[model samples]
Target: MSMERIATALDRVSAALRRKPQAGIHDDAAATARWDGGLRTRVLHDAGHELLTDMPAEIGGEDGAPTPGWFMRAGLASCAVTRIAMAAAAEGIRLETLEARASSRSDTRGMLLIPEADGSAVPAQPLEIALHVRIGAPGVPAERLRTLVEWTARCSPVGCTVEQPMPLALHVDVAS
Candidate 1:
């Protein structure tokens, strides 16, 4: 959609949200993943879309698809891009170029369950996640674009979730 349309739509939503703040708080549909075989899985979303994940051959997988960690990084990049674009549109900034890249460093020892020298458990999460964003808009100040990117980082849902600690619950079912 055009930036003008996006601005109009965002304004409408903002007004509605201001009037009924509770309307913004709601649960999203759950995504279910089913194991397909050795280190491969298929995830189904509520919208009938499916995503596949697989480990490399070294990890006993066929390498038919990308690893789950890859998907996580992709999600982060895409979410940041979307949020940045939305903000740009709302602010009447005509963006000529916008790109976001997400990268992380992880230790395989943690996932492989290798024992540490100090006997401390290795973290399964990435050691660091970095997002590099390149954006430009004709006639817009560089500082303004930087500020927009910074604001988008704080507002991006996936970014926020990854940055903050939240409670998670797991349940198991036994089948006969």
Candidate 2:
């Protein structure tokens, strides 16, 4: 879809969430760790009394352009970075290219059930990831730089959560 269309759709989703009452968000501080065969997942909330997450980059994403599935992928990507960027920064790592793409594999029986995940491990959710990272500070050695990335992945709240699920939930979505 055109970027304009995506923007409009994102506007609507954002508007809807803003309209929700603050008291509606529960837990503010609680969640669970999920394991499906091999993939790991986590459901966390510092919703802090807010009903939704503060990922403005996404809620304001291309309107219905993302369809719900695409939107979820965006969130997955955003959160993946959200949970790791700090670690990279703390280590004083300089990053140039950091791209993580998520994939899904679903059975003929049912797909698209991931969004319904209520703070639980949504199998086949982000089935595979192709990560391309380039980091080289003025003085950091390549080997040491690689370790920083390893540490990031190790502490990646979302990716690390899904390392063991066999056949994990793998599916793809087509924006209609």
Candidate 3:
């Protein structure tokens, strides 16, 4: 879709949300992941969408699909792109090129629950995450693009989620 159309749609949504603040609250459907085999899982989402995750052969997996961490990185990249596009459209900036690249470093010992040399606990999360965004537009200042990218980082859903961890509630049920 054209940026003008996107801007129009966004304006409509923004007006609606302003009129009814509660309209901005979104409750997403639950996504369930079932283990397909060793170190492999199949996730089911809305509209019959399915995603698969598997570790490398060295990790006792078939290496058939991307790992969960890869998916998280992909999500962050895609979400940043989406937010950037939206912001540019709203601001009437016609982008010639836009890209977001996300990368992270993970410690295997942390993931495997291996204790440190001092018998301390290691975090099971990525040690560092980085996102590099490239954006270009004709007749637009580079500083403006930088500001837009910074704004996108603050507003992107996945970016925000990764930056600020949320509380998770886990429930387990024993099957007969």
Task: Put down candidate 1 lDDT per residue, 1-176, tens digits, no spaces.
Answer: 99999999999999999999999999988989999988999999999999999998986999999999999999899999999999999999999999999999999889988868999988888999999999999999999999999999999999998899599898999989
Task: Name every residue pair that clashes in candidate 3.
Answer: none
Q: Which pairs clash in model 1? A: none
Per-residue alpha-carbon lDDT of model 3 for 1-176, expressed as tens digits?
99999999999999999999997898887788999989999999977999999999986899999999999999999999999999999999999999999999988889889989999988899999999998999999999999999987888999999999899888889999
Model 2 clash count equals: 29
- The digit string of per-residue lDDT tens for model 2 on 1-176 reads 44345456656655777897574456534443232222223334455332222212333322312333443555456655544445455554555545556555443213334443365545543445444454446666878767766777776645554554356465677779
Runs in model 3 lying further than 4 Å from the true structure: none
Comparison by lDDT, 1 against 2, better one = 1
**Candidate 2 displacement at residue 102 in angstroms:** 2.8
What Cα-based lDDT does every candidate model obtain? 0.94, 0.49, 0.94
Q: Indicate the residue-level lDDT of 156 in model 2.
A: 63
lDDT of 2 at 28: 34
